[model samples]
Target: MNVCTTGCDISSIHLTCGWFSSARLINPRVFKRLRYNDCLVNNGNRLANGHTISFQYANTFRYPLSVSSVRC
Candidate 1:
């Protein structure tokens, strides 16, 4: 993890089951989400390179993810 030098973003990255979800940068506004079922997502697994790491994930099933976000 060595890809944090200021501004960076890893957003809207869609991944299915058995797939890999990775990010590299230094953006606090980086958003990640899930919409399907039986899928594992990691929002802080640095694979390429970056600063600041976290272990955020979710398991979606049945209905779609209900999120009230600012549509901009």
Candidate 2:
């Protein structure tokens, strides 16, 4: 997962994956929409072919988003 909160533009970093994951940004000053494989969310995103994930937030924040959970 990737999170950019320090005025860093994450436009050049191309990410592709074949698993269930989510990327989110908690910054309240960045309004960057995300492009994903499953659907479009304002914050972080997920690229899945036929996977199901969980989400709880609506409405756009700074809008910058994406994340993944590393199971230990």
Candidate 3:
């Protein structure tokens, strides 16, 4: 699983995976979404496929047209 937080023009991310028998571990933050294959193999071993990954981006706007216009 992954967790993320953002503020203004900057953002941060964290990732972790559950313990497993395999030495390979994926960073949860690296993918905004993911999927797995039902069946696959290579070198007489099961292979991974159909896994999708994505990233989330934050948008920022600079400068204000009128910062004090709405001040009371």
For candidate 2, lDDT tens digit of each residue in 2-30? 24344433222222322323255434222
Q: What is the TM-score of each candidate against the true structure?
A: 0.21, 0.18, 0.17
Write one digit per residue (lDDT tens) for candidate 3, span 1-72: 112233222122212211212233434434221212111112112112332234333334321111111101
Where does model 2 exceed 4 Å of error? Answer: 1-49, 58-62, 67-72
Off by over 4 Å in 1: 19-53, 56-72
Among these predictions, the greatest TM-score belongs to 1
Local accuracy of candidate 1 as per-residue lDDT tens digits, 1-72: 235454554322233433323344323334343443223223434333364334444335322433232111
Mind sharing the TM-score for model 1? 0.21
Count of backbone clashes, every candidate in sequence: 1, 11, 0
Whole-model lDDT, model 1: 0.34
Instruction: Go through the candidates in order and give the C-alpha RMSD of each one to the true structure.
Output: 11.6, 13.5, 20.8
